[model samples]
Target: GAGVSQSPSNKVTEKGKDVELRCDPISGHTALYWYRQSLGQGLEFLIYFQGNSAPDKSGLPSDRFSAERTGGSVSTLTIQRTQQEDSAVYLCASSLGVRNSPLHFGNGTRLTVT
Candidate 1:
């Protein structure tokens, strides 16, 4: 894909279930990011991956949330023991690098925890 791509555009899961969101960045983009937006809320940074460096997971709200990027191309976000508060649209974005470039965002994955 020429831009970021996210899968499972919509997901409905019971509370306590686990879910995984996938993202495929542009062919040569070296910077990738994951963010979450709750209803009526702003985007919250979740994690960031730049090249071969260790991903910055400080934005993750809990230990239950984790992410990883492989081959500097694909990334995945895993949420454990989902809660109602976890319901939100997960967005993935990519750029040539962290600076001097606009990010290309994917259609988010809308997650609903019942």
Candidate 2:
């Protein structure tokens, strides 16, 4: 794909259920990031990976939230024990290996835990 792709464009799960969102970055891109955007809020960075390694995973809200990038291009974000508050758009971004690049985003997976 020319752009990033994410699965389950919208999800509705019961409260306390777990959810997993996936992201496929542009081919050959070595950097990936996951973020969450609550309604009416800005994007909050969650985790980031460079190459096949993650040097930063500090932004995960809690142990319940985790992510991993495989082969440096695909990523998955798992939310355990989901809550209504966790109902937000989970976004994935990828960029060239540089600090000064614009992040290209997948149309995020909107998780709605009711």
Best by TM-score: 1
Clash list (residue pairs), candidate 2:
none
Candidate 1 clash pair list: none
TM-score of each model, paired residue for residue:
0.96, 0.93
Alpha-carbon lDDT, every model: 0.93, 0.88
Q: Judging by lDDT against the true structure, name the best candidate.
A: 1
RMSD of 1: 1.1
The residue-level lDDT of candidate 1 at 39 comes to 76
Each model's total of backbone clashes: 0, 0
Residues 1-114, model 1: lDDT tens digits: 467889999999999999999999988899999999987889999999999999898899999899988889999999999999999999999999956999899999999999
Global Cα lDDT for candidate 1: 0.93
For model 2, the stretches where C-alpha displacement exceeds 4 angstroms are none
Clashes of 2: 0
Error of 1 at 86 (Å): 0.4
